[model samples]
Target: MVDPDRVLVPTLGRPREDEALAYALETFPDADVTLLAVVTPLDAPLSEGGVLERSEERTARARASATDLLESVADPTATERIRVETADGRPGTVIPQYASTEGVDHVVMYGHGTDTSGFVRRILGRGIAATVVERTDEPVTVLE
Candidate 1:
Protein backbone atom coordinates (compact mmCIF):
# COMPACT_ATOMS: atom_id res chain seq x y z
CA MET A 1 0.00 0.00 0.00
CA VAL A 2 1.24 3.47 -0.87
CA ASP A 3 1.22 5.27 2.46
CA PRO A 4 0.92 8.90 1.57
CA ASP A 5 0.86 10.64 4.94
CA ARG A 6 -0.95 13.75 3.73
CA VAL A 7 -2.76 15.06 0.68
CA LEU A 8 -3.53 18.79 0.44
CA VAL A 9 -6.38 20.05 -1.70
CA PRO A 10 -6.74 23.80 -2.16
CA THR A 11 -10.42 24.61 -2.67
CA LEU A 12 -12.05 27.89 -3.63
CA GLY A 13 -15.72 27.03 -3.93
CA ARG A 14 -14.91 25.28 -7.21
CA PRO A 15 -16.40 22.04 -8.42
CA ARG A 16 -12.98 20.87 -9.57
CA GLU A 17 -12.11 20.05 -5.97
CA ASP A 18 -14.42 17.04 -6.05
CA GLU A 19 -12.63 15.67 -9.06
CA ALA A 20 -9.29 16.31 -7.43
CA LEU A 21 -10.27 14.55 -4.23
CA ALA A 22 -11.67 11.59 -6.11
CA TYR A 23 -8.51 11.35 -8.12
CA ALA A 24 -6.42 11.39 -4.99
CA LEU A 25 -8.41 8.54 -3.53
CA GLU A 26 -7.99 6.46 -6.67
CA THR A 27 -4.29 7.21 -6.90
CA PHE A 28 -3.41 6.47 -3.30
CA PRO A 29 -5.93 3.99 -2.00
CA ASP A 30 -4.15 3.22 1.23
CA ALA A 31 -2.71 6.64 1.89
CA ASP A 32 -3.97 8.77 4.76
CA VAL A 33 -5.37 11.81 2.98
CA THR A 34 -6.18 14.94 4.94
CA LEU A 35 -8.13 17.57 3.05
CA LEU A 36 -6.60 20.89 4.12
CA ALA A 37 -8.60 24.08 3.83
CA VAL A 38 -6.36 27.11 4.27
CA VAL A 39 -8.05 30.30 5.41
CA THR A 40 -6.17 33.38 4.25
CA PRO A 41 -6.94 36.41 6.41
CA LEU A 42 -8.06 39.63 4.79
CA ASP A 43 -5.24 41.90 3.63
CA ALA A 44 -6.52 45.21 4.96
CA PRO A 45 -4.68 46.71 7.93
CA LEU A 46 -6.12 46.82 11.43
CA SER A 47 -9.13 49.10 11.86
CA GLU A 48 -11.62 50.01 14.59
CA GLY A 49 -12.25 46.38 15.43
CA GLY A 50 -8.48 45.72 15.59
CA VAL A 51 -6.43 43.33 13.47
CA LEU A 52 -6.81 40.41 15.80
CA GLU A 53 -10.58 40.76 15.95
CA ARG A 54 -10.92 40.94 12.20
CA SER A 55 -8.61 37.98 11.80
CA GLU A 56 -10.60 35.96 14.29
CA GLU A 57 -13.86 36.66 12.50
CA ARG A 58 -12.37 35.78 9.16
CA THR A 59 -10.89 32.62 10.57
CA ALA A 60 -14.21 31.51 12.02
CA ARG A 61 -16.02 31.95 8.75
CA ALA A 62 -13.26 30.24 6.85
CA ARG A 63 -13.33 27.25 9.16
CA ALA A 64 -17.10 26.95 8.84
CA SER A 65 -16.93 27.19 5.08
CA ALA A 66 -14.18 24.66 4.93
CA THR A 67 -16.17 22.22 7.00
CA ASP A 68 -19.18 22.62 4.78
CA LEU A 69 -17.14 22.19 1.62
CA LEU A 70 -15.40 19.09 2.89
CA GLU A 71 -18.62 17.60 4.20
CA SER A 72 -20.22 18.07 0.85
CA VAL A 73 -17.42 16.26 -0.97
CA ALA A 74 -16.58 13.52 1.48
CA ASP A 75 -17.90 9.98 1.12
CA PRO A 76 -19.03 8.78 4.50
CA THR A 77 -18.87 5.15 3.47
CA ALA A 78 -15.35 5.39 2.15
CA THR A 79 -12.34 4.18 4.03
CA GLU A 80 -11.47 5.74 7.39
CA ARG A 81 -8.10 7.02 6.21
CA ILE A 82 -9.41 10.39 5.14
CA ARG A 83 -9.43 13.39 7.54
CA VAL A 84 -10.18 17.10 7.25
CA GLU A 85 -8.44 20.10 8.82
CA THR A 86 -8.82 23.85 8.53
CA ALA A 87 -5.97 26.23 9.32
CA ASP A 88 -5.89 30.02 9.38
CA GLY A 89 -2.63 31.09 7.80
CA ARG A 90 -0.94 31.77 4.49
CA PRO A 91 -1.32 28.82 2.16
CA GLY A 92 2.36 28.41 1.54
CA THR A 93 3.21 28.61 5.22
CA VAL A 94 0.33 26.63 6.66
CA ILE A 95 0.41 23.78 4.16
CA PRO A 96 4.06 22.94 4.63
CA GLN A 97 3.83 23.44 8.35
CA TYR A 98 0.96 20.98 8.67
CA ALA A 99 2.66 18.54 6.34
CA SER A 100 5.91 18.68 8.23
CA THR A 101 4.29 18.27 11.62
CA GLU A 102 2.02 15.55 10.32
CA GLY A 103 4.87 13.70 8.66
CA VAL A 104 3.28 13.96 5.24
CA ASP A 105 4.96 11.94 2.52
CA HIS A 106 3.01 13.36 -0.42
CA VAL A 107 1.01 16.43 -1.40
CA VAL A 108 -1.74 16.03 -3.99
CA MET A 109 -3.39 19.12 -5.43
CA TYR A 110 -5.21 20.38 -8.53
CA GLY A 111 -3.97 23.28 -10.61
CA HIS A 112 -6.24 25.64 -12.46
CA GLY A 113 -5.41 25.61 -16.14
CA THR A 114 -4.69 28.68 -18.20
CA ASP A 115 -7.72 30.69 -19.15
CA THR A 116 -8.70 31.00 -22.79
CA SER A 117 -6.57 34.11 -22.86
CA GLY A 118 -2.81 33.97 -23.32
CA PHE A 119 -0.63 31.82 -21.11
CA VAL A 120 0.95 34.63 -19.13
CA ARG A 121 -1.70 34.71 -16.44
CA ARG A 122 -1.66 30.94 -16.09
CA ILE A 123 2.07 30.89 -15.71
CA LEU A 124 2.11 33.68 -13.19
CA GLY A 125 -0.99 32.50 -11.34
CA ARG A 126 0.66 29.22 -10.45
CA GLY A 127 2.12 30.87 -7.36
CA ILE A 128 0.21 28.84 -4.79
CA ALA A 129 0.96 25.51 -6.43
CA ALA A 130 4.54 26.47 -7.06
CA THR A 131 5.03 27.81 -3.56
CA VAL A 132 3.76 24.56 -2.12
CA VAL A 133 6.14 22.64 -4.34
CA GLU A 134 9.12 24.79 -3.39
CA ARG A 135 8.38 24.77 0.35
CA THR A 136 7.81 21.08 0.87
CA ASP A 137 10.37 18.29 0.72
CA GLU A 138 7.59 15.78 -0.02
CA PRO A 139 6.49 14.85 -3.51
CA VAL A 140 3.68 16.98 -5.00
CA THR A 141 1.26 15.88 -7.67
CA VAL A 142 -0.55 18.76 -9.34
CA LEU A 143 -3.59 17.68 -11.33
CA GLU A 144 -4.67 19.88 -14.19
Candidate 2:
Protein backbone atom coordinates (compact mmCIF):
# COMPACT_ATOMS: atom_id res chain seq x y z
CA MET A 1 0.00 0.00 0.00
CA VAL A 2 1.12 3.57 -0.68
CA ASP A 3 2.21 5.47 2.39
CA PRO A 4 -0.42 8.01 3.28
CA ASP A 5 0.41 11.69 3.32
CA ARG A 6 -1.99 12.36 6.20
CA VAL A 7 -3.49 9.88 8.64
CA LEU A 8 -6.30 10.40 11.12
CA VAL A 9 -6.50 8.39 14.33
CA PRO A 10 -9.47 8.94 16.62
CA THR A 11 -8.71 8.26 20.23
CA LEU A 12 -11.15 7.73 23.10
CA GLY A 13 -8.69 7.31 25.98
CA ARG A 14 -8.61 3.59 25.33
CA PRO A 15 -5.69 1.18 25.17
CA ARG A 16 -6.83 0.17 21.72
CA GLU A 17 -6.37 3.75 20.64
CA ASP A 18 -2.77 3.66 21.75
CA GLU A 19 -2.26 0.43 19.90
CA ALA A 20 -3.69 1.85 16.72
CA LEU A 21 -1.59 4.99 17.05
CA ALA A 22 1.58 3.04 17.64
CA TYR A 23 0.86 0.91 14.62
CA ALA A 24 0.23 3.94 12.48
CA LEU A 25 3.37 5.64 13.65
CA GLU A 26 5.47 2.63 12.82
CA THR A 27 3.80 1.92 9.50
CA PHE A 28 3.64 5.44 8.19
CA PRO A 29 6.65 7.18 9.62
CA ASP A 30 6.43 10.00 7.13
CA ALA A 31 2.71 10.63 7.37
CA ASP A 32 1.40 13.57 9.31
CA VAL A 33 -0.54 12.11 12.23
CA THR A 34 -3.58 13.90 13.53
CA LEU A 35 -4.63 12.71 16.98
CA LEU A 36 -8.34 13.41 17.33
CA ALA A 37 -10.57 13.08 20.35
CA VAL A 38 -14.30 13.71 20.32
CA VAL A 39 -15.88 14.88 23.54
CA THR A 40 -19.53 13.94 23.60
CA PRO A 41 -21.91 16.17 25.52
CA LEU A 42 -22.53 15.03 29.07
CA ASP A 43 -25.68 13.02 29.55
CA ALA A 44 -26.42 14.31 33.04
CA PRO A 45 -29.32 16.70 33.50
CA LEU A 46 -28.36 19.80 35.42
CA SER A 47 -28.88 23.56 35.60
CA GLU A 48 -27.63 25.46 32.56
CA GLY A 49 -24.81 27.05 34.50
CA GLY A 50 -23.70 23.73 35.92
CA VAL A 51 -23.95 22.09 32.54
CA LEU A 52 -21.81 24.75 30.89
CA GLU A 53 -19.18 24.54 33.59
CA ARG A 54 -19.08 20.76 33.47
CA SER A 55 -18.84 20.77 29.72
CA GLU A 56 -15.94 23.19 29.80
CA GLU A 57 -14.18 21.07 32.39
CA ARG A 58 -14.69 17.91 30.37
CA THR A 59 -13.33 19.54 27.22
CA ALA A 60 -10.28 20.83 29.04
CA ARG A 61 -9.57 17.45 30.61
CA ALA A 62 -9.97 15.63 27.34
CA ARG A 63 -7.62 18.03 25.56
CA ALA A 64 -5.01 17.71 28.28
CA SER A 65 -5.26 13.95 28.29
CA ALA A 66 -5.00 13.82 24.52
CA THR A 67 -1.96 16.05 24.59
CA ASP A 68 -0.30 13.83 27.16
CA LEU A 69 -1.03 10.69 25.22
CA LEU A 70 0.33 12.15 22.02
CA GLU A 71 3.41 13.45 23.78
CA SER A 72 4.07 10.10 25.38
CA VAL A 73 4.08 8.27 22.07
CA ALA A 74 5.24 10.88 19.58
CA ASP A 75 8.85 10.77 18.53
CA PRO A 76 10.65 13.98 19.25
CA THR A 77 12.05 14.01 15.76
CA ALA A 78 8.50 13.95 14.37
CA THR A 79 6.94 16.48 16.70
CA GLU A 80 6.39 18.90 13.89
CA ARG A 81 4.19 16.41 12.08
CA ILE A 82 2.06 15.36 15.03
CA ARG A 83 -1.04 17.34 15.92
CA VAL A 84 -3.42 17.11 18.86
CA GLU A 85 -7.03 18.09 18.23
CA THR A 86 -10.46 17.72 19.83
CA ALA A 87 -14.03 18.26 18.64
CA ASP A 88 -17.38 18.55 20.39
CA GLY A 89 -19.75 16.05 18.79
CA ARG A 90 -20.40 12.36 18.38
CA PRO A 91 -17.21 10.59 17.30
CA GLY A 92 -19.13 8.76 14.60
CA THR A 93 -19.96 11.98 12.82
CA VAL A 94 -17.10 14.19 13.86
CA ILE A 95 -14.26 11.83 13.07
CA PRO A 96 -15.28 11.26 9.51
CA GLN A 97 -16.13 14.90 9.04
CA TYR A 98 -12.76 15.95 10.31
CA ALA A 99 -10.97 13.45 8.13
CA SER A 100 -12.82 14.61 5.06
CA THR A 101 -12.35 18.29 5.80
CA GLU A 102 -8.67 17.83 6.48
CA GLY A 103 -8.12 15.76 3.35
CA VAL A 104 -6.81 12.79 5.24
CA ASP A 105 -5.29 10.09 3.07
CA HIS A 106 -6.18 7.25 5.39
CA VAL A 107 -7.46 6.33 8.83
CA VAL A 108 -5.95 3.89 11.28
CA MET A 109 -8.07 2.64 14.14
CA TYR A 110 -8.87 -0.30 16.41
CA GLY A 111 -11.75 -2.64 15.84
CA HIS A 112 -14.33 -3.71 18.37
CA GLY A 113 -13.82 -7.27 19.56
CA THR A 114 -15.87 -10.31 18.62
CA ASP A 115 -16.87 -11.12 22.20
CA THR A 116 -20.33 -10.56 23.64
CA SER A 117 -19.67 -7.15 25.14
CA GLY A 118 -17.90 -5.97 22.02
CA PHE A 119 -20.71 -7.23 19.90
CA VAL A 120 -23.19 -5.28 21.98
CA ARG A 121 -21.04 -2.19 21.79
CA ARG A 122 -20.83 -2.44 18.01
CA ILE A 123 -24.59 -2.94 17.74
CA LEU A 124 -25.23 0.11 19.87
CA GLY A 125 -22.77 2.15 17.80
CA ARG A 126 -20.52 2.62 20.81
CA GLY A 127 -17.58 1.58 18.62
CA ILE A 128 -17.00 4.94 17.05
CA ALA A 129 -14.05 3.72 15.03
CA ALA A 130 -16.29 1.32 13.18
CA THR A 131 -18.79 4.07 12.59
CA VAL A 132 -16.04 6.34 11.30
CA VAL A 133 -15.04 3.67 8.81
CA GLU A 134 -18.58 3.45 7.49
CA ARG A 135 -18.88 7.22 7.18
CA THR A 136 -15.61 8.00 5.42
CA ASP A 137 -14.37 7.22 1.92
CA GLU A 138 -10.74 7.17 3.04
CA PRO A 139 -9.10 3.78 3.36
CA VAL A 140 -9.18 2.50 6.94
CA THR A 141 -6.76 0.11 8.53
CA VAL A 142 -8.31 -1.50 11.60
CA LEU A 143 -6.08 -3.01 14.24
CA GLU A 144 -7.29 -5.94 16.32
Q: Rate the local accuracy (lDDT) of all candidates.
A: 0.65, 0.76
Candidate 2's error at 81, in angstroms? 0.9
Q: lDDT at 40 for candidate 2?
A: 70
lDDT of 1 by residue, 18-94 (tens): 76677777777767777776666555111122345666675566566656766666676654777767776667678
TM-score of 1: 0.72
- Candidate 2 versus the native: TM-score? 0.82
Clashing pairs in 1: none
Candidate 1: residue 111 Cα off by (Å): 1.2
What are the runs in model 1 whose C-alpha is more than 4 Å off? Answer: 1-3, 12-15, 44-57, 112-126
Which whole-number lDDT from 0 to 100 does residue 14 have in model 1?
Answer: 40
Give the per-residue lDDT digits (tens) of candidate 2, residues 1-144.
788999988876656577787888999999999988767755521111235567778777778877887778777887798888888776677888998999999998877432338566655645555677789999988887
How much lDDT does candidate 2 score? 0.76
